[model samples]
Target: MSTATITPKGPGTLRGARLPKWSPYAIAAGSIALAVGIGLAGGLHSRVQWGLIAAILYVVGTYAIATAVEGKRQAKDRIATSLVWVAFLLAVIPLASLVWSTVARGLKVLDVYFLTHSMGVVADTEPGGGIYHAILGTLEQVGLATVIAAPIGVLTAIYLVEYGRGRLSQAITFFVDVMTGIPSIVAGLFILSLMLMFDMQPFGFAGSLALAILMMPVVVRSTEEMLKLVPNELREASLALGVPKWRTILKVVLPTSIGGITTGIMLSIARITGETAPVLLLVWGNAFINANPFEGAQASLPLYIYQQYANSAGSGAAYDRAWAASLTLIAFVMLLNLVARGIARWKAPKTGR
Candidate 1:
């Protein structure tokens, strides 16, 4: 007897059609065109409304087309990917618009004269004043705040990660969490209340104190996370070499995590740099330069912008100054971020090649 040979199909035999890589771009372009047509027909004047309509159409159209061509399972996956891209665009568009607006409006009056001179005698309606006073005050207050906050924050983080135990550690963690959620205004108010009790006047140091309050919790949180990332084996190995616990931590733990710690500190500073309410309540914005942070009222970029805009009374010059100051503040924060990234990269521990 002879038996016929039989063959079975492999799992790889089945495959489905896929949309091209350029399909998303085509869909997005079509969605924008349709959205614009709808906006024009409906007499919708707001670009924001047009964008919202476009985003919605893009998501819906992507899913519909995918389902039609590639069945339900593939369509669901495509929908998810499309949603993520839509969300990214939604976030980026506003930020791009804001940066563009600030740059465009700021260039009108931003020049060397504007940078060197303070408000000194310039009237709100007049065009010649600069942010010198605000810049000086910002540097002093932020410097003092960093001095006060960084060590305390780093120490607290060390204790929590290395030495903390029992109810005390829990309490400390609870308070840290509470402080993290406290509003900038509330921190300012807390310091303001202390100043009121002492009958103290507004000064740059007071604003620094409020900023320190905000900075500490962020520093603590970031440092704690970074320290935790340090391998326990490093600590064990150090201890095996007859090193004291504190020395091991200082030499091994901190160095290993220093890059992350520095980045976090810089980010925390950036967070506080934009605060207006705290500085307004504590620093009591000054029109002229005040070099002394501890003794007298001082200005900050946020306060300067607010005062310029509020006191403008429809003055074009004041509006221009406000926009220029905003641009400068943005540049400062961006620089800090760049520096932080650079430091992190430079100090990052080398691994196997």
Candidate 2:
């Protein structure tokens, strides 16, 4: 009988490669050490500053350490991971600063009375006013804008994705691309000019019209992307069932794209919510809270911020109110984002159990 030769495979031959036991621990230790080192060295009083320094140091140290341990090929991936974290940290900084600044200043004026009261009785020279009017204007204008833009945007997207392949479609697409970058002031001016031609006086409706224009291209682009993501097989299957094309689109296509469409619409709303020029040039503003968008001047959050800062006396109370209003605006945007996320999650396609 011949003795069979046994051979052992190298560690690299494992189908699922395992990380070295010390690698992660080494990386963590290096990150923590560098973070603490830099943070302490910076001598900053603010916790935000300390956290930022720590984050930056952690990433740099981790990358350097990863490069030493991993071969150059793997080291590139490690460097990329570190860079992504750095980018994430950079984005977080301004968001954190905004929140902190708003909270610190807003706390001085965020009483229950502040939320319910308007600026009607408050003197411009004095302080202790509220943003009830501004809040109402923001809600009505943004709500009306959504109502106006949603149908047009969804239809345009449908046309582009389904029937658009030629010159007309290309023209529409090109215009939409151009409109995406049109200055906010240009939208305001366009609405102003259109209203002037109709001999209509400036009103909240004009502001709403301008906002809708601002919102439309964003909605169209976003909806187009979502519609394009729908598999052609779904469309073919629907047609195979003897369904009308419009019916198939209304049922199968729209339902499949609804989640993303909703997300896009929400984003579009956010995009135009803070627009000041359109509202200022069109609706103007009023101190009293007005529920109707058609009849009178209205004040929104951005306009309110502008008015308070520009018109208010140097009283601490006025400054406090401005900060509080800013906080409320930020809160509204955050809430919308959360709701959009929830809708997207709930409406996501179901897979196998």
Candidate 3:
């Protein structure tokens, strides 16, 4: 009876030890302190160097500590995570530094007056002038380029994504890719060559033509990707309801992807906004405000910044103005990005509806 009732004991569970929640923070702090000590001892003056050392130390320390407390598998996982965090911090540090430097240097001269007045009758060495003319030209040139690029780009994208069938589509795609990589200087040169042939002078519209050249490929690529993301089921449903292909595309496909399309267009605009070479070659920077883009040379923000810096010849006033203009350009691009995001959110398709 005893032999019949005998049972084996269950196997005991083996649990690996885990690191505490605060271990990563503790490791990071220690690594930073050690890095600072090493920097001071080694006479390393660069903060970037110190950060790089700290990042290395953190990764190594994490892996070693994790290996001691947990198993090799857990240690490897922590190392991967630590590396990712290190990479993220490395990226963020430079961006933060750039923003900090720009804001600090730009605030010395940036003001309402700086934004509202033009550099009229004021020498680069003088203390007073503004970006009014530059802003006007920038707006006009970018607007004209947008007007030229958006519709053509969108239509090209539609044909490629919706109706493209053969070698023509493939050739278009290849050319678009080629255009995307063409340098701003090259685009300017191309337009300059055309203008030379026609005996035309530098004007805002000339800059617009170069910018449009740069912008079109970006818009076409973005719109094509967005259109491709529209569900084929939507197209089929519309077709089943006796809707023509064009109407279905206009009503269904476009609405579904309008958010993305608008964001893409805005991003393209931002990309061309900071171009200096094209504007310098085509717009031929003006000191006074010019209202008409077609008739005369215009001053754009990029060209203004460049001209200020180049003509300053170590003048503090011109340098300050350059910094201020840079800040304004950055602000303009940031505003465009914010507006793009807002538009995208507003136009995003509602799943609940």
> Whose TM-score is greatest here?
3
Q: All models: lDDT?
A: 0.92, 0.82, 0.93
Query: Candidate 2 deviates by what RMSD?
Result: 6.5
List the lowest-lDDT window of 10 residues for candidate 3.
Answer: 1-10
The ten-residue window of minimal lDDT in model 2 covers 1-10
Please identify model 1 stretches exceeding 4 Å from their true place: 1-12
lDDT digits (tens) for residues 229-346 of candidate 3? 9999999999999999999999999999999999999999999999999999999999999989998999999999999999998899999999899999999999999999999999
What are the clash counts of all predictions, listed in order?
A: 0, 0, 0
- In angstroms, give how far residue 256 of model 2 lies from its true place: 1.2
Predicted structure 2: lDDT: 0.82
Per-residue lDDT over 1-353 for candidate 2, one digit per residue giving the tens place of the 0 to 100 score: 01112245458664332236455445556566666666678665776666666566656655555455444666677667767867886798798988899999888888778877899988766777788888888989988988999899999999999989889999999999999999888999998888889887666777888999999999999999999999999999999999999999999999998899999998888888889988888888888988888886887888888788787667666777888988888888888888888898888888859
TM-score for each predicted model, relative to the true structure: 0.94, 0.84, 0.95
For candidate 3, the lDDT comes to 0.93
